[model samples]
Target: MKRMLSLVVTTAALLLALPASAQFAKPEDAIKYRKSALTVMGTHWARLAGMAQGRIPYDAKAAADNAAVLEVAHKLPWAAFGADTQSGDTKAKSEIWKEPAKFKEAEERLFAEVPKIVAAARSGKQDDLKAAFAAGGGVCKNCHDNFRQ
Candidate 1:
Protein backbone atom coordinates (compact mmCIF):
# COMPACT_ATOMS: atom_id res chain seq x y z
CA MET A 1 0.00 0.00 0.00
CA LYS A 2 2.82 2.36 0.84
CA ARG A 3 4.57 1.61 -2.47
CA MET A 4 1.34 2.22 -4.37
CA LEU A 5 0.86 5.51 -2.54
CA SER A 6 4.40 6.59 -3.40
CA LEU A 7 3.89 5.85 -7.11
CA VAL A 8 0.63 7.77 -7.15
CA VAL A 9 2.26 10.77 -5.54
CA THR A 10 5.14 10.62 -8.03
CA THR A 11 2.73 10.49 -10.95
CA ALA A 12 0.75 13.45 -9.64
CA ALA A 13 3.92 15.48 -9.18
CA LEU A 14 5.06 14.72 -12.73
CA LEU A 15 1.68 15.73 -14.13
CA LEU A 16 1.76 18.99 -12.21
CA ALA A 17 5.20 19.78 -13.62
CA LEU A 18 4.05 19.48 -17.22
CA PRO A 19 3.44 22.60 -19.32
CA ALA A 20 -0.12 23.91 -19.22
CA SER A 21 -0.78 23.03 -22.85
CA ALA A 22 0.32 19.47 -22.22
CA GLN A 23 -1.72 19.17 -19.05
CA PHE A 24 -5.19 18.91 -20.54
CA ALA A 25 -5.97 15.30 -21.39
CA LYS A 26 -9.58 16.06 -22.28
CA PRO A 27 -11.53 18.77 -24.07
CA GLU A 28 -13.61 19.31 -20.97
CA ASP A 29 -10.49 20.20 -19.05
CA ALA A 30 -9.61 22.84 -21.61
CA ILE A 31 -13.14 24.21 -21.52
CA LYS A 32 -13.02 24.43 -17.75
CA TYR A 33 -9.67 26.22 -17.90
CA ARG A 34 -10.96 28.78 -20.40
CA LYS A 35 -14.11 29.36 -18.37
CA SER A 36 -12.09 29.91 -15.22
CA ALA A 37 -9.76 32.36 -16.97
CA LEU A 38 -12.72 34.29 -18.41
CA THR A 39 -14.35 34.46 -14.99
CA VAL A 40 -11.22 36.00 -13.52
CA MET A 41 -10.94 38.44 -16.43
CA GLY A 42 -14.57 39.45 -16.03
CA THR A 43 -14.08 40.09 -12.31
CA HIS A 44 -11.11 42.36 -12.97
CA TRP A 45 -12.82 44.04 -15.90
CA ALA A 46 -15.87 44.79 -13.78
CA ARG A 47 -13.69 46.44 -11.15
CA LEU A 48 -12.07 48.66 -13.74
CA ALA A 49 -15.43 49.47 -15.33
CA GLY A 50 -16.87 50.49 -11.99
CA MET A 51 -14.13 53.07 -11.63
CA ALA A 52 -14.48 54.16 -15.26
CA GLN A 53 -18.24 54.63 -14.96
CA GLY A 54 -17.82 56.47 -11.68
CA ARG A 55 -19.82 53.77 -9.90
CA ILE A 56 -16.80 53.35 -7.68
CA PRO A 57 -14.16 55.83 -6.60
CA TYR A 58 -11.05 55.72 -8.71
CA ASP A 59 -7.83 54.61 -7.13
CA ALA A 60 -4.91 54.91 -9.50
CA LYS A 61 -3.18 51.90 -8.03
CA ALA A 62 -6.24 49.67 -8.12
CA ALA A 63 -7.07 50.70 -11.67
CA ALA A 64 -3.55 49.97 -12.73
CA ASP A 65 -3.56 46.60 -11.03
CA ASN A 66 -6.87 45.58 -12.61
CA ALA A 67 -5.75 46.76 -16.03
CA ALA A 68 -2.56 44.74 -15.70
CA VAL A 69 -4.59 41.67 -14.82
CA LEU A 70 -6.86 42.23 -17.85
CA GLU A 71 -3.81 42.48 -20.08
CA VAL A 72 -2.71 39.01 -19.04
CA ALA A 73 -6.13 37.42 -18.63
CA HIS A 74 -7.33 38.51 -22.05
CA LYS A 75 -4.64 36.35 -23.64
CA LEU A 76 -5.48 33.19 -21.73
CA PRO A 77 -8.90 31.92 -22.92
CA TRP A 78 -8.27 31.58 -26.63
CA ALA A 79 -6.04 28.56 -26.40
CA ALA A 80 -8.70 26.63 -24.56
CA PHE A 81 -11.29 27.10 -27.29
CA GLY A 82 -10.01 24.08 -29.11
CA ALA A 83 -11.96 22.27 -31.84
CA ASP A 84 -12.96 19.53 -29.50
CA THR A 85 -14.31 22.06 -27.01
CA GLN A 86 -17.24 23.19 -29.13
CA SER A 87 -19.89 21.36 -27.16
CA GLY A 88 -19.62 22.31 -23.54
CA ASP A 89 -21.16 24.29 -20.74
CA THR A 90 -20.11 27.52 -22.43
CA LYS A 91 -21.98 30.52 -23.68
CA ALA A 92 -19.73 30.55 -26.74
CA LYS A 93 -21.73 30.62 -29.93
CA SER A 94 -21.26 28.27 -32.88
CA GLU A 95 -20.28 31.23 -35.03
CA ILE A 96 -16.88 31.22 -33.40
CA TRP A 97 -16.13 28.10 -35.40
CA LYS A 98 -18.39 28.83 -38.34
CA GLU A 99 -17.22 32.39 -38.81
CA PRO A 100 -13.62 32.06 -37.84
CA ALA A 101 -12.45 35.16 -39.68
CA LYS A 102 -14.94 37.43 -37.99
CA PHE A 103 -14.19 35.91 -34.62
CA LYS A 104 -10.50 36.41 -35.22
CA GLU A 105 -11.12 40.03 -36.07
CA ALA A 106 -13.01 40.54 -32.85
CA GLU A 107 -10.17 38.87 -30.94
CA GLU A 108 -7.68 41.13 -32.67
CA ARG A 109 -9.69 44.17 -31.68
CA LEU A 110 -9.65 43.09 -28.03
CA PHE A 111 -5.92 42.39 -28.10
CA ALA A 112 -5.31 45.80 -29.57
CA GLU A 113 -7.46 47.68 -27.05
CA VAL A 114 -6.37 46.00 -23.79
CA PRO A 115 -2.86 47.45 -23.90
CA LYS A 116 -4.27 50.96 -24.34
CA ILE A 117 -6.26 50.47 -21.15
CA VAL A 118 -3.15 49.31 -19.36
CA ALA A 119 -1.17 52.28 -20.60
CA ALA A 120 -3.90 54.74 -19.67
CA ALA A 121 -4.28 53.27 -16.20
CA ARG A 122 -0.53 53.35 -15.64
CA SER A 123 -0.46 56.98 -16.74
CA GLY A 124 -2.61 57.91 -13.71
CA LYS A 125 -5.00 60.03 -15.74
CA GLN A 126 -8.56 59.25 -14.73
CA ASP A 127 -10.09 60.77 -17.84
CA ASP A 128 -7.82 58.87 -20.17
CA LEU A 129 -8.38 55.70 -18.18
CA LYS A 130 -12.13 56.15 -18.39
CA ALA A 131 -12.01 56.52 -22.14
CA ALA A 132 -9.70 53.58 -22.52
CA PHE A 133 -11.88 51.52 -20.24
CA ALA A 134 -14.95 52.24 -22.38
CA ALA A 135 -13.08 51.35 -25.52
CA GLY A 136 -11.90 48.10 -24.00
CA GLY A 137 -15.36 47.27 -22.74
CA GLY A 138 -16.75 47.96 -26.19
CA VAL A 139 -14.29 45.55 -27.65
CA CYS A 140 -15.42 42.89 -25.19
CA LYS A 141 -19.05 43.65 -25.83
CA ASN A 142 -18.55 43.36 -29.54
CA CYS A 143 -17.05 39.91 -29.15
CA HIS A 144 -19.76 38.84 -26.74
CA ASP A 145 -22.54 40.05 -28.98
CA ASN A 146 -21.18 38.07 -31.86
CA PHE A 147 -19.68 35.00 -30.21
CA ARG A 148 -21.28 34.46 -26.86
CA GLN A 149 -24.77 33.34 -25.95
Candidate 2:
Protein backbone atom coordinates (compact mmCIF):
# COMPACT_ATOMS: atom_id res chain seq x y z
CA MET A 1 0.00 0.00 0.00
CA LYS A 2 2.82 2.37 0.77
CA ARG A 3 4.43 1.52 -2.54
CA MET A 4 1.19 2.23 -4.42
CA LEU A 5 0.72 5.52 -2.58
CA SER A 6 4.30 6.52 -3.36
CA LEU A 7 3.79 5.65 -7.02
CA VAL A 8 0.62 7.73 -7.18
CA VAL A 9 2.30 10.66 -5.52
CA THR A 10 5.28 10.39 -7.86
CA THR A 11 3.08 10.19 -10.95
CA ALA A 12 0.99 13.13 -9.76
CA ALA A 13 4.13 15.19 -9.18
CA LEU A 14 5.46 14.42 -12.64
CA LEU A 15 2.20 15.27 -14.35
CA LEU A 16 1.86 18.49 -12.35
CA ALA A 17 5.36 19.53 -13.34
CA LEU A 18 4.58 19.50 -17.06
CA PRO A 19 3.74 22.73 -18.89
CA ALA A 20 0.20 23.36 -20.09
CA SER A 21 1.21 22.55 -23.66
CA ALA A 22 2.52 19.13 -22.74
CA GLN A 23 1.30 16.66 -25.32
CA PHE A 24 1.37 12.91 -25.39
CA ALA A 25 3.06 11.44 -28.45
CA LYS A 26 -0.01 9.32 -29.11
CA PRO A 27 -3.66 9.60 -28.17
CA GLU A 28 -3.50 6.20 -26.55
CA ASP A 29 -0.79 7.44 -24.25
CA ALA A 30 -3.02 10.29 -23.14
CA ILE A 31 -5.88 7.87 -22.55
CA LYS A 32 -3.65 5.58 -20.54
CA TYR A 33 -2.28 8.43 -18.49
CA ARG A 34 -5.68 9.89 -17.70
CA LYS A 35 -7.11 6.50 -16.85
CA SER A 36 -4.27 5.76 -14.49
CA ALA A 37 -4.68 9.12 -12.82
CA LEU A 38 -8.41 8.68 -12.45
CA THR A 39 -7.91 5.21 -11.04
CA VAL A 40 -5.66 6.59 -8.37
CA MET A 41 -8.14 9.34 -7.56
CA GLY A 42 -10.98 6.84 -7.42
CA THR A 43 -9.07 4.57 -5.11
CA HIS A 44 -8.49 7.36 -2.63
CA TRP A 45 -12.02 8.61 -3.02
CA ALA A 46 -13.51 5.21 -2.28
CA ARG A 47 -11.59 5.04 0.96
CA LEU A 48 -12.89 8.41 2.09
CA ALA A 49 -16.39 7.67 0.92
CA GLY A 50 -16.44 4.43 2.80
CA MET A 51 -15.58 6.28 5.99
CA ALA A 52 -18.05 9.06 5.29
CA GLN A 53 -20.92 6.65 4.64
CA GLY A 54 -20.18 4.67 7.77
CA ARG A 55 -19.13 1.57 5.86
CA ILE A 56 -15.65 1.86 7.27
CA PRO A 57 -14.33 2.95 10.63
CA TYR A 58 -13.43 6.60 10.45
CA ASP A 59 -9.91 7.35 11.49
CA ALA A 60 -9.01 11.01 11.39
CA LYS A 61 -5.47 10.24 10.32
CA ALA A 62 -6.63 7.94 7.55
CA ALA A 63 -9.22 10.42 6.32
CA ALA A 64 -6.68 13.21 6.23
CA ASP A 65 -4.15 11.04 4.45
CA ASN A 66 -6.61 9.89 1.82
CA ALA A 67 -7.88 13.41 1.32
CA ALA A 68 -4.34 14.67 0.83
CA VAL A 69 -3.66 11.98 -1.74
CA LEU A 70 -6.93 12.91 -3.43
CA GLU A 71 -5.99 16.57 -3.52
CA VAL A 72 -3.07 15.70 -5.78
CA ALA A 73 -4.68 12.86 -7.73
CA HIS A 74 -7.78 14.87 -8.59
CA LYS A 75 -5.74 17.44 -10.46
CA LEU A 76 -3.78 14.91 -12.47
CA PRO A 77 -6.41 13.64 -14.91
CA TRP A 78 -7.71 16.84 -16.50
CA ALA A 79 -4.47 17.69 -18.29
CA ALA A 80 -4.55 14.46 -20.24
CA PHE A 81 -7.93 15.14 -21.87
CA GLY A 82 -6.41 16.60 -25.01
CA ALA A 83 -8.49 16.95 -28.17
CA ASP A 84 -6.76 14.06 -29.84
CA THR A 85 -7.61 11.85 -26.89
CA GLN A 86 -11.34 11.95 -27.55
CA SER A 87 -11.16 8.71 -29.40
CA GLY A 88 -9.29 5.90 -27.70
CA ASP A 89 -9.52 3.30 -24.97
CA THR A 90 -11.33 5.81 -22.76
CA LYS A 91 -14.75 6.23 -21.32
CA ALA A 92 -14.70 9.95 -22.07
CA LYS A 93 -17.59 11.14 -24.16
CA SER A 94 -17.32 13.23 -27.34
CA GLU A 95 -18.99 16.11 -25.51
CA ILE A 96 -15.76 16.67 -23.62
CA TRP A 97 -14.05 17.91 -26.76
CA LYS A 98 -17.05 19.22 -28.62
CA GLU A 99 -18.06 21.34 -25.70
CA PRO A 100 -14.77 22.23 -24.16
CA ALA A 101 -16.04 25.27 -22.28
CA LYS A 102 -18.78 23.36 -20.53
CA PHE A 103 -16.44 20.52 -19.76
CA LYS A 104 -13.92 22.95 -18.30
CA GLU A 105 -16.61 24.55 -16.18
CA ALA A 106 -17.50 21.19 -14.77
CA GLU A 107 -13.85 20.48 -14.13
CA GLU A 108 -13.50 23.83 -12.40
CA ARG A 109 -16.49 23.02 -10.23
CA LEU A 110 -14.88 19.79 -9.10
CA PHE A 111 -11.62 21.62 -8.44
CA ALA A 112 -13.50 24.06 -6.28
CA GLU A 113 -14.92 21.33 -4.07
CA VAL A 114 -11.77 19.31 -3.44
CA PRO A 115 -10.22 21.80 -1.05
CA LYS A 116 -13.31 21.69 1.12
CA ILE A 117 -12.94 17.95 1.50
CA VAL A 118 -9.26 18.41 2.25
CA ALA A 119 -10.02 21.00 4.90
CA ALA A 120 -12.77 18.92 6.43
CA ALA A 121 -10.59 15.85 6.62
CA ARG A 122 -7.79 17.82 8.16
CA SER A 123 -10.16 19.21 10.76
CA GLY A 124 -10.61 15.75 12.23
CA LYS A 125 -14.37 16.08 12.17
CA GLN A 126 -16.20 13.13 10.71
CA ASP A 127 -19.41 15.10 10.14
CA ASP A 128 -17.54 17.79 8.27
CA LEU A 129 -15.82 15.15 6.21
CA LYS A 130 -19.15 13.58 5.39
CA ALA A 131 -20.63 16.85 4.20
CA ALA A 132 -17.63 17.79 2.13
CA PHE A 133 -17.40 14.32 0.69
CA ALA A 134 -21.03 14.42 -0.36
CA ALA A 135 -20.60 17.77 -2.06
CA GLY A 136 -17.42 16.71 -3.83
CA GLY A 137 -18.92 13.40 -4.90
CA GLY A 138 -21.93 15.20 -6.32
CA VAL A 139 -19.64 17.31 -8.46
CA CYS A 140 -17.86 14.16 -9.58
CA LYS A 141 -21.15 12.51 -10.48
CA ASN A 142 -22.18 15.53 -12.52
CA CYS A 143 -19.01 15.29 -14.55
CA HIS A 144 -19.24 11.53 -14.93
CA ASP A 145 -22.87 11.64 -15.97
CA ASN A 146 -22.27 14.31 -18.58
CA PHE A 147 -18.76 13.65 -19.81
CA ARG A 148 -18.16 9.95 -19.40
CA GLN A 149 -19.63 6.91 -21.05
Candidate 3:
Protein backbone atom coordinates (compact mmCIF):
# COMPACT_ATOMS: atom_id res chain seq x y z
CA MET A 1 0.00 0.00 0.00
CA LYS A 2 2.80 2.39 0.86
CA ARG A 3 4.55 1.70 -2.44
CA MET A 4 1.35 2.18 -4.40
CA LEU A 5 0.59 5.41 -2.60
CA SER A 6 4.09 6.66 -3.23
CA LEU A 7 3.80 5.96 -6.93
CA VAL A 8 0.44 7.68 -7.14
CA VAL A 9 1.85 10.71 -5.38
CA THR A 10 4.78 10.85 -7.75
CA THR A 11 2.59 10.51 -10.85
CA ALA A 12 0.16 13.11 -9.62
CA ALA A 13 2.96 15.56 -8.91
CA LEU A 14 4.36 15.09 -12.40
CA LEU A 15 0.97 15.58 -13.99
CA LEU A 16 0.39 18.70 -11.95
CA ALA A 17 3.60 20.23 -13.18
CA LEU A 18 2.33 20.33 -16.75
CA PRO A 19 -0.06 22.99 -17.99
CA ALA A 20 -3.46 21.50 -18.80
CA SER A 21 -3.57 23.25 -22.16
CA ALA A 22 -0.27 21.65 -23.15
CA GLN A 23 -0.95 18.19 -21.80
CA PHE A 24 -2.08 16.73 -25.12
CA ALA A 25 -0.39 17.06 -28.45
CA LYS A 26 -3.68 16.80 -30.31
CA PRO A 27 -7.40 16.99 -29.60
CA GLU A 28 -7.77 13.24 -30.16
CA ASP A 29 -5.02 12.62 -27.64
CA ALA A 30 -6.97 14.50 -25.00
CA ILE A 31 -10.06 12.53 -25.83
CA LYS A 32 -8.14 9.30 -25.49
CA TYR A 33 -6.63 10.41 -22.20
CA ARG A 34 -10.00 11.39 -20.83
CA LYS A 35 -11.58 8.13 -21.94
CA SER A 36 -8.79 6.01 -20.52
CA ALA A 37 -8.89 7.75 -17.15
CA LEU A 38 -12.66 7.54 -16.95
CA THR A 39 -12.52 3.84 -17.84
CA VAL A 40 -10.10 3.17 -15.00
CA MET A 41 -12.19 5.21 -12.58
CA GLY A 42 -15.34 3.42 -13.75
CA THR A 43 -13.78 0.02 -13.25
CA HIS A 44 -12.85 0.66 -9.63
CA TRP A 45 -16.12 2.47 -9.02
CA ALA A 46 -18.03 -0.59 -10.25
CA ARG A 47 -16.23 -2.84 -7.83
CA LEU A 48 -16.99 -0.57 -4.88
CA ALA A 49 -20.59 -0.10 -6.01
CA GLY A 50 -21.08 -3.83 -6.36
CA MET A 51 -19.87 -4.43 -2.86
CA ALA A 52 -22.00 -1.61 -1.44
CA GLN A 53 -25.12 -2.85 -3.23
CA GLY A 54 -24.48 -6.45 -2.24
CA ARG A 55 -24.01 -7.71 -5.79
CA ILE A 56 -20.50 -8.56 -4.70
CA PRO A 57 -19.68 -9.62 -1.20
CA TYR A 58 -18.20 -6.87 0.91
CA ASP A 59 -14.61 -7.42 1.93
CA ALA A 60 -12.97 -4.61 3.85
CA LYS A 61 -9.60 -5.10 2.26
CA ALA A 62 -11.03 -5.12 -1.24
CA ALA A 63 -13.04 -2.00 -0.52
CA ALA A 64 -9.95 -0.25 0.76
CA ASP A 65 -7.92 -1.31 -2.24
CA ASN A 66 -10.55 -0.16 -4.73
CA ALA A 67 -11.11 3.11 -2.96
CA ALA A 68 -7.38 3.77 -2.86
CA VAL A 69 -7.17 3.42 -6.63
CA LEU A 70 -10.31 5.52 -7.01
CA GLU A 71 -8.73 8.33 -5.01
CA VAL A 72 -6.27 8.85 -7.83
CA ALA A 73 -8.41 7.76 -10.77
CA HIS A 74 -11.26 10.14 -10.13
CA LYS A 75 -9.01 13.20 -10.42
CA LEU A 76 -7.58 12.30 -13.82
CA PRO A 77 -10.15 13.05 -16.53
CA TRP A 78 -11.00 16.62 -15.57
CA ALA A 79 -7.69 18.09 -16.69
CA ALA A 80 -8.23 16.70 -20.20
CA PHE A 81 -11.48 18.57 -20.74
CA GLY A 82 -9.89 21.60 -22.31
CA ALA A 83 -11.54 23.63 -25.07
CA ASP A 84 -9.36 22.11 -27.75
CA THR A 85 -10.52 18.61 -26.81
CA GLN A 86 -14.25 19.34 -26.89
CA SER A 87 -14.79 18.35 -30.53
CA GLY A 88 -13.34 14.90 -30.63
CA ASP A 89 -14.42 11.28 -30.25
CA THR A 90 -16.16 11.94 -26.96
CA LYS A 91 -19.67 11.74 -25.62
CA ALA A 92 -19.22 15.03 -23.78
CA LYS A 93 -22.13 17.32 -24.46
CA SER A 94 -21.93 20.93 -25.54
CA GLU A 95 -23.49 21.86 -22.26
CA ILE A 96 -20.18 21.28 -20.55
CA TRP A 97 -18.61 24.14 -22.43
CA LYS A 98 -21.84 26.13 -22.52
CA GLU A 99 -22.36 25.91 -18.79
CA PRO A 100 -18.86 25.81 -17.43
CA ALA A 101 -19.91 26.89 -13.95
CA LYS A 102 -22.44 24.10 -13.62
CA PHE A 103 -20.02 21.55 -14.97
CA LYS A 104 -17.37 22.77 -12.54
CA GLU A 105 -19.84 22.49 -9.68
CA ALA A 106 -20.47 18.87 -10.51
CA GLU A 107 -16.74 18.20 -10.66
CA GLU A 108 -16.17 19.90 -7.31
CA ARG A 109 -18.94 17.90 -5.71
CA LEU A 110 -17.42 14.63 -6.82
CA PHE A 111 -13.99 15.76 -5.70
CA ALA A 112 -15.36 16.58 -2.27
CA GLU A 113 -17.13 13.24 -1.93
CA VAL A 114 -14.30 10.93 -2.90
CA PRO A 115 -12.45 11.41 0.37
CA LYS A 116 -15.56 10.32 2.25
CA ILE A 117 -15.53 7.11 0.27
CA VAL A 118 -11.86 6.53 1.07
CA ALA A 119 -12.59 7.16 4.75
CA ALA A 120 -15.63 4.87 4.77
CA ALA A 121 -13.76 2.10 3.05
CA ARG A 122 -10.93 2.42 5.54
CA SER A 123 -13.48 2.17 8.33
CA GLY A 124 -14.25 -1.42 7.38
CA LYS A 125 -17.95 -0.76 7.78
CA GLN A 126 -20.38 -1.80 5.07
CA ASP A 127 -23.06 0.70 6.07
CA ASP A 128 -20.55 3.53 5.90
CA LEU A 129 -19.43 2.36 2.51
CA LYS A 130 -23.02 2.19 1.27
CA ALA A 131 -23.78 5.73 2.38
CA ALA A 132 -20.61 7.15 0.86
CA PHE A 133 -21.17 5.23 -2.36
CA ALA A 134 -24.69 6.61 -2.73
CA ALA A 135 -23.56 10.20 -2.20
CA GLY A 136 -20.57 9.87 -4.51
CA GLY A 137 -22.57 8.03 -7.18
CA GLY A 138 -25.17 10.75 -7.16
CA VAL A 139 -22.49 13.30 -8.00
CA CYS A 140 -21.14 11.05 -10.75
CA LYS A 141 -24.58 10.42 -12.21
CA ASN A 142 -25.38 14.12 -12.12
CA CYS A 143 -22.35 14.81 -14.31
CA HIS A 144 -23.39 12.08 -16.74
CA ASP A 145 -26.92 13.42 -16.94
CA ASN A 146 -25.86 17.00 -17.50
CA PHE A 147 -22.49 16.96 -19.22
CA ARG A 148 -22.15 13.62 -20.95
CA GLN A 149 -24.05 12.15 -23.84
Query: Would you list the C-alpha lDDT of every candidate in the order shown?
Result: 0.85, 0.87, 0.90
Please state every model's RMSD to the true fold in angstroms.
Answer: 6.3, 6.6, 4.9
Q: Is candidate 2 or candidate 3 better by TM-score?
A: 3
List where candidate 2 sits over 4 angstroms from the true fold.
1-21
TM-score versus the correct structure, for each prediction = 0.82, 0.84, 0.87
Clashes of 2: 0
Ten-residue segment with the worst summed lDDT in candidate 3? 133-142
- Candidate 2 lDDT over 1-149, as tens digits, reads 99999999999998878853375777788899899999999998889889888899999999989998998999989888877777867889999988999999998998898888888888998999899877776888889899999
Of 1 and 3, the candidate ahead on TM-score is 3
Instruction: Using TM-score, give the best candidate's number.
Output: 3
Model 1, span 1-149: residue lDDT tens: 99999999999999866665576798889889999999998898888888888898999999989988988998988877766778878888989989989998998998888888788888877898889876666888899998999
Q: What's the lDDT of the predicted structure labeled candidate 1? A: 0.85
Clashes of each: 0, 0, 0
Looking at model 1, which ten-residue stretch has the lowest summed lDDT? Answer: 15-24
For 34-135, candidate 3 gives per-residue lDDT tens digits of 999999999998898898899999999999999999999999999888888778689999998899999999999989988998888889999999998877
Which segments of candidate 3 are over 4 A away from where they belong?
1-17
